[model samples]
Target: MAIPPDIKDSIAKVKPLSQSAVRLMSIMADPDHTVAQIAAVVESDPILTGNVLRVVNSPAFGLRAKISTVARAVSYTGGNMVVGLALHLCASGIFNNPLDGYESQRGSLWRHCLFTAIASREIARFSDGKADPEVAYTAGLLHDIGKAVMSAPLGDSARKIIAIADKGEMPDFVAGEAKAVGTDHPEVGEAIAIHWSLPGPLREVIRHHHAPSKAKEEYRTLVYAVHLGDFIAMMSGTGTGADTMLYLLDHDYRNFVDISAAELEKVILDAGQEYQQVVESMFGSEEEMQ
Candidate 1:
């Protein structure tokens, strides 16, 4: 679907990710970027380096030993995980705002995004071969970027959409956004990703997460992972928005990831534990981030 010019303009006004995040993302985009290169970029910023070590030692990675150095963290968790940790830390400022349109309190969306990203990583790890953990993490982290854009400058419009959504007039947040703005957040997010020249698969996941079957076949697995992760985050009450329980869980999610109900239960349980630690790694505590 083509993005409306109005939505494109709205997305343009949404702030770009921080330069440090962009640099880490650029390095991660290169398949050949070495762990040393990733560690070097992360180490350039003391905060990012600390966050990387925090994440590596956190229960999120299930590491038996604490990592004290960026190089060691990268070696322990892979370059992609290290880069993702850096991006999350550097980009926290951007996600810390309240999403008025989505009814997300200050830092709520950030918590949701963090949980979803971690859930996506776990889903990929258990996919048996359908997805990449690192790629899934990035996709899940950014799947709702357009929602932020839509919520930033379109508060009144979003209120109207949300009212309609509350009445069951729309299928989900994406549908309500399209009804109010002539384009949904996913489309606007796709445009924003294109504007930023983000990787193609990342753009696809952001665009088609609401409809993974409609995405390019190459990215369908990744999209499915993010979609399920998003659902899991909402269901787990991981600091989500008013749209919580508004979206439908794909009944056939098992077809994509081959995870049983029992396994998925474990994922949600583990994600809740990691979510607290991940949030602490980036923002200290819920009170502080807010």
Candidate 2:
């Protein structure tokens, strides 16, 4: 289906991922890049550096000594983690708005993304998959970026799609979205990711998090990680939106990862508490009262 002209125009105006973020991902992709080189690139952007430090020092990592510098953070979290956190920090502002049809509040979507990211790391740890926990985390954080893109101008259409899905018991929200808006958020998100030249795996995860069975082998694990993480967060009521429970678990997802319903419950319970603490630390005294 062709993208509607209005939606296409809005999407055309949306900014690509920041250059600093692109540079960081490039450095991460290069095996020869050293810690100092990565640090140098990150340090060039003061805002990005500050946000990265905030995340590393937040309750999530729980480091003993306060990390005050980019190099120290890179040393502590490793290059991949540093890059992941950088991407997270850079993209945090993108999903801070409410999608028209979704119940995600201002910043609520971001919180959901954050929770999914944290849960993804836990899933990775348990499955012992080749997936980098940090990469999984970043993928989880960005899985819903397309919703943000679609909602900017197509908010009304998106809202109608969600309403139909909710009222008619549609099997898939994406189908409802396609019926209402000519495209699903995942496809739109993939387009946006492609425009930004995101890492291939990260792009695949964003495109396929909602449908992990369709992803390539290497990407399927990460996709499932984010998918499971999203479900766990929604079920736990961590930072869920309107469409939180609109989707069902893919049967194939069960075969890709070793997580059980019991284990998932435990992760959600634990991550919920950690999520609140992290949000409190990140926002300082303004943590959403739930």
Candidate 3:
């Protein structure tokens, strides 16, 4: 299926992640990067700096001593959390807006992404350290970004795509999208990731999350981690729209992640609780989220 040219243009027009945010992500992806290095990037952007302090000091962390410096916040919260704050501050427009093609309300996609991030982090814990939980969290946060690009182009056909999935005519909503619209969110997400110059792991995870088995061998574990995370988000009622649980699960995830049924349930519950706190910290208040 060929992606429409207009969608290509839309992908190009999508705002690039801030320079500081990009730098932070790059630094965070390297496990050996120091806290001071990450803090230096966050401190370079005042908005990111304030958000780091705010998130670290938020009730989510329950730190009695207020974090007064970016260095301290980075040290306390870790590079993944600091990078997430930077991305949230810079990409709120992309995250907060409604995906009309999906018939999702404003802010629902962001909530879904946030929930997936937490779930992905938890799920990666079961990966025997083959996959980095921190990277999994960031990948989950941005996994469906292609949906934002595909949304408008898909338009009213989204209903048709949903129908295709519901009637079992397609294997999943992504397949429905391909049959109905000639492309799917994950494909579009790959374009956006490339457009944004996102890290290789992120680009691959965003692209292959729905079909983890199709990912390259080295990346399959991380992709499967995010795939499960995305599923848990939708199952927990934080899906972006009608396509929520319509996607097929790659049961082979057990081979990659080693999460037992009971452990999966615990992850869902714990991640759900963490998601609420993270959302509040990132967005300030429920009112602001809307």
Question: Tens-digit lDDT track for model 3 on 166-221?
Answer: 77777888887887677899999999999998988999999999999999888889
* Model 3 TM-score on a 0 to 1 scale: 0.94
Candidate 1 structure quality by residue, lDDT tens digits, 1-290:
56677667766765566666777777765556788887887788877777677767766567777778888887876765565565556555446678887777877776777788889889877777768777788777778777766775456665676678789877887777776666777887788788767888889989988788888987788888998998889888774576677676666667778887798899999988877765665456778667
- TM-score against native, each model: 0.84, 0.82, 0.94
Candidate 1: count the clashes: 0
Candidates, ranked, lDDT: 3, 1, 2
Residue lDDT tens for model 2, 58-129: 775778989998888777656655554565556655666556566556776777777888888788666565
Q: Lowest lDDT 10-mer window, candidate 1?
A: 85-94
Q: Backbone clashes per model, in order?
A: 0, 1, 0
Note the Cα lDDT for every prediction shown. Answer: 0.75, 0.72, 0.85
Better of 1 and 2 by TM-score: 1
What CA RMSD would candidate 2 show?
Answer: 3.5
Clashes of 3: 0
Which stretches in model 1 have alpha-carbon errors above 4 Å? 1-6, 14-20, 26-34, 45-47, 50-68, 73-81, 89-93, 157-163
Candidate 3, which segments miss by more than 4 Å at Cα?
A: 59-61
* Superior candidate under lDDT, 2 versus 3: 3
